[model samples]
Target: MTTYQETVAAEATIAEQAWAETFGRAMAAVAGCFARRETRATMAELVAGLLMEVDTRNCWTLGQALGHPGPHRLQHLLSRARFDHERAREEIARLVAGELAGQEVVLVADETGDAKSSTDCVGAGPQYSGALGGVGLCQVAVHLAAVTATMKVIVDRALYLPADWAADEERREVAGVPEEVVFATKPQQALSMVTGVLASGLDARWFAGDEVYCGRELRRGIRALGLGYTVGIAATYQVTDGAGHRWEARKLINKVRPEQWLRRRTGHGAKGTREYDWAWLEVRPDDTPGGNGNGNGNGNAAGAGAGAGTSVLVARRHRYTGEVSYFRCWAPGDVPLGTLVEVICRRWRIEETFQLAKGFTGLDQGQVTCWNSWMRWSLFSLIAAAVLALTAAAVHDGSERQPRLVPLTCPELIRLLRAIVLSPPARDRDHVLHWTAWRRHHQAVATACHQQRHRRHDQP
Candidate 1:
């Protein structure tokens, strides 16, 4: 007879097998990046080290993650390895598409900026960091990710080169910036990533981004490729009514009747469903359209008439505060309002993915100064994130019905990885337990204080 302990043991074995199979597939996807057998072996080691629990993700820390005393091999792999990171990126995209492909999957382009203190760090400059929510010294990268209902993973990334860095030959040489690297706007960078991913044969049903990537050239480019897109637009963006009347997005909000708003849940959150009221209205491009699409209405007067297709302006209102936001969507055929809303909701998945990658896999924790090294680190970190995401999907999904519980989250899976795979010694384990206990105690105290205040308010 199968006892409870035996059943648990069997389940553990199955889970481990699942992980091993997925990890093997991920490694194989990037195997062609390495030319020599030794480099291939080193690539495996680098990927495994990135998956392990470590204080940081650098050559030295990764050596520690692999239980090594030095970082020479890892350093060589990043700094002097002969493999092309771009080809590796293609493999990563292929792997992600295989794991989480759907006809309705969204291709998302967004910029992530990590604050940097050192001026010598590659691409570091005083720039506006969306991650930091303000202007600061940082390195910015444009990321292209594939997102669906079940998973989100970055498939391509490009570092943003500031105009000064691109113009200064001496600084470029010192930082090892490629000779071909030139200053391009964020939207232009996004289009290049989309073009590259398309060239690699990866497919997506829709393209999406924040307002930063919603330029005239980008919209036209996507249309030229026969792709649909839903991108955020500033409140000041102008569009024509179906009758060729021009109005800014903000102005159209007042034109929406109360009956047009639908209260819907945007997505699931840590607490519960994220509910908001949404409304949409049909709008068209101008009669003539050769402009930059920067919302300044300059360049080409053919703005709304670029494709002579249907476009929609969407408005979202916070249920509690009544705060409102807006988005513009351009899709082929008669796309349902619900479908467009779902596409807009999927935008938050990219933001959540960034949080998970940075928090668990150290997406922004590299200490490299060279351009190639930074790219290598990002590739490895993304690989680690992919493993975690795939493993979580396996553990939570599948037909094996052993026990039912809340689905595993990225943080929980990361903790399990640390406990089982990293296998900290007794002393380190004890320290972690102590830290957890302290945190629990602090939470208890805060909860008690909150309850006391509530009780007093009720009595009064």
Candidate 2:
């Protein structure tokens, strides 16, 4: 009979192998995006560096961690390297879709910002960044994520350019912004990304977003693609109730009877089940003029034909704070309130994706200023994140359940990956001496600059 310790060791080895194999296959799927063998190899190394633990995931540190003499090669990979990052993005979407096959999928849209100190960076300006918690100088990128019960992965992204940035030719040239690129709103960006992902043949049942994406264009666009939506709307959004009366979402929801509100669990959380009181009221679809359900002015009416679809205004109240939120919902048939609430809850998954991508895969750690470099770095970081997510999902599916043990998570999986699957950084005497000399040389140059500045100030 095998001893308990031996069995445990064997299982651990198997788990490590699973992680290695999963990562290898994911990288291989996107290999075609790079034409030359050398570029492909460098791309692989850059991704590996992103996966490794580094204080800052710029070319300098990543190059050093990967045992390189200088940051030139990695910098080139982001800046001037001739590789099809757009194709790579498509490949990433397909890879994620394949991994999540046979699962209920919801396409989620959101944007994230990286704070910047200077306006020299492309798309960096005073903007409202939820990540920054207010208006700040930053670069915002809109992203669309595919989510399921147990997995979430970002499938597409686009950099948001402010109006002035788009019109400034000199600054655009300096930042390498393509001439064809122009200013598009966040909802437009989300619509474009979602359209591209769906056009790539990735099937999703619903599209979800926050209040920012609750515009008529995006809603009608999503419905045109034959997908339902449960998008948040501002409390003041106008809606026509079933009685043909127009009222603000908040005012309309207040009319709901106390007994009509049903308490339902959205999903399981760290604490326990997230339960909320939900209520629904039938509403006139906004596709028609005056929302009268009569004439179509935009040629995109919700439920254009009889028995085609249904639209409703849904509200959710917190069980504790009693604070209420509203959503404008549409579905093909008369779906239950629970289904719409589930989609509403899944909107939070994109936020979770932002956190994981930034934390584990260095999604927001790029130091580049040019447009192409920024895009390449973001795409590579996302690829690294996808690898971790796929590995965690695979490990959880295959591993035996133990009492009192939670399922494998992306962070824990990354720890195991660095510990076993990834090659350890070189720690030999020669390697250590080289890094030591390099750091000291850098410090010497910095000290010289500081001393020169102080001398100039003293003389003045």
Candidate 3:
């Protein structure tokens, strides 16, 4: 019922078609991401699957979009997606260093696991669960992208999760290692990608990530690389003060900045509504007495914690109205605290990518196999997503005294959706669905949702 409109806007040339062009450009840019060309399907078939329809055969096109090529495209573009994302990230880093983009933006890192049925996938196994429904053999990967000026998402890293099931030599053989790909910890796989992106000779002011990647080694790696970082760390994991007195990040926030703890700010209230106080200090992690997360060697937590490193830590005070809350940031001590804070906040932009890719661009709907086709399919969806956003941005060019950085509204979203669905040769139904009618449909949906909530006694 709900849809994206500006994504479907009209254009004279496919080249001039801003949304379509954006998708095309992204695909072209990521074209060489693969080392071998895959025959999954042609690029056209990939794009068509999303635009028109998808069947079993055409699904390979979507794989190409994702960075996989069937034996067909593998010869041309068949490598991991990390390389492409890294290249794009390097571009963003270059822009940042050249002062073309803001350094105060967030560099969010997150990993999403994909459930797969095939045990033969080069990298797939049952591991820690992240999805809501259940757990199965799945691949986990972390993506790093920069978010600034309320636009732009450059994914720099894509690390595949390698489960222990594939760790043993026999298991590796059965799972089929090509000899080039070695056994690596999930964190290591992710770190390699992160390091590569940074090694791309690009500079970023900060980095942020979820807990899976917030391990001590990862933090230490970032710090060693001289970068700032923020993460949604476990509340139970503690941080020690210069005096060697340790307290959980959550406990410290509660003890040091109680008022802001358990703050409940969401959506619109997130921006401008809350600001943070910044502080920097030395940090050392110790495993809690037992079974915490530090893996036993360290005394911070149980199974996982940053091992033996005195790193720079930042404490941020988040204030909601009159109450003040707290959070600590960890990074290479040399970097400024402000830079770390800026980068940590940028992680929010990735949420937009997920929304657009799945909800707006229709990337999540694919049910195909083979690495190549999957890659193409994903790429097409990604390109389409970027194009829609860019076109919507291009639509507004006014020099207002106070310009709205967030361009495009729900109306624009719907407009883009309608554009693709409504083609040439207007039908009788098209005449019935004029601007007025469209607006009414939009209002009706919103109103109906509200009424439904009211009926359920959960009206907002």
Candidate 4:
């Protein structure tokens, strides 16, 4: 008998308590990261501000949100505070595992670029911004997220310093870059994060990523660690057919018979099921153990397929268009195709996490210019994002009674947090209603404009 909005409101009220509990527990986990009690208290306020909507996510604005008399304390907490950010990340890994425990937790690795116009920001240099889809001046960081069917949270991150910046002694000293911090490629950064995750005993079943991490050594290393992986590889990657003949991935996929490709729902999209034509071919087994994923050996050996390792080439074809993509995977010989597809699709969850964190919690909106500050701000941002995600998961689990109602999203949860934090008096209901109507109108116009842009593209 209750209306959808009323139910949502009730759920939001319930989720607030969950958020507070989550935040408190998370703060406790990260308490040891700060050397001083004052620093920990200030970090709690900053994280609370980040969880709520704010005009800006800098120290000045955050201090105002926490009703601080001045911004000096908050500024010191980030820029000059003595805390072990790396240890905080380790704590986060454990906390995340506790929050979203599952049998088959997935670790997704990716890098995101944060645009920085000022060169003074630590690790800020002209680098390829993946967000921009082209080369642009930005600061890039390699991040790893723990993802499950219900939620996703970034548990590890490392800033990427260009070789030039690493080599610049003056710049390094001025920006507070550590003496031990050297230039590492994105893949290497990912490997370090993966190693950290494994060391933390996070129970990750699979490691997934794009071509940036599909190098031969990386794949070998992941296998050596006894972790399964499905990573993107180039179309030109070489493999062997059943007859032991070498072929490029694209050519091999093209040779896949029509009957071999099956239309399967890879995963769920925003609207509904995402179905695609998928086909897979097992690589010729290597006579030697731990061979690179490429299949260069003859397939006629009697016990070759029963060896210790298995490699495979999996291809996905667009349902609408025949456009195909390739991935090279190394796993146990008997792993199912559906399991491979699910792991491959989990790589996109990190992108979704990035969007949610950046849009609502200012994941890339900090103004710090020191190494310590950058690390601390990122740690707090991840905590805020995890709180939001865990709370949303709780709300979603409780909203099953109303079939017509939709589950809560990250943005909606963030808005609810803002409303709870900034609850106005009942006398101001008319004013709040007026602004709410205006916001809905603005959203409608924006949605129509977005749709029109797509329509124009379709027309052309």
Show the lowest summed lDDT stretch of 10 residues, model 3.
1-10
Residue pairs clashing in model 1 are: 285-304, 286-304, 288-301, 288-302, 289-302, 289-303, 290-300, 291-300
Candidate 3, backbone clash total: 78
- Per-residue lDDT of candidate 3, residues 315-417 (tens digit): 4544534432233465432444445555655666686676556654555455433344344445556555554545544444321212323445423443544
TM-score per candidate: 0.84, 0.90, 0.60, 0.86
Candidate 4 regions off by >4 Å? Answer: 1-6, 284-305, 421-460
- Taking the candidates one at a time, how many backbone clashes does each contain? 8, 0, 78, 0
lDDT, model 1, position 6: 59
Q: Whose lDDT is greatest here? A: 2
Each model's lDDT comes to 0.76, 0.83, 0.49, 0.78
Q: lDDT tens string, model 2, 1-460?
A: 2454454455467668776787688778888888788988998888877878777788877877889877789888898988888899988888787787788899999999999998899999999999999999999999999999898888899999999988888989999998888999999999889888877778898999999999888887887778889999999999876555779999998889999999998888889889999998877677532343432233323332325476888999999999999999888777888888888898998998899889878888888899989999999998888887877777777767554556667886777678877776556788768877887898899999999999999994
Q: How do all the candidates rank in terms of lDDT, highest first?
A: 2, 4, 1, 3
User: Residue 97 of candidate 3: its Cα lDDT?
Assistant: 34
lDDT of 3 at 196: 68
Off by over 4 Å in 3: 1-17, 20-41, 44-105, 152-154, 157-159, 168-177, 254-327, 331-342, 360-406, 409-460
For candidate 4, give the lDDT of residue 124. Answer: 85
Better of 2 and 4 by TM-score: 2
lDDT of 4 by residue, 329-362 (tens): 7675567778888888888889999998787677
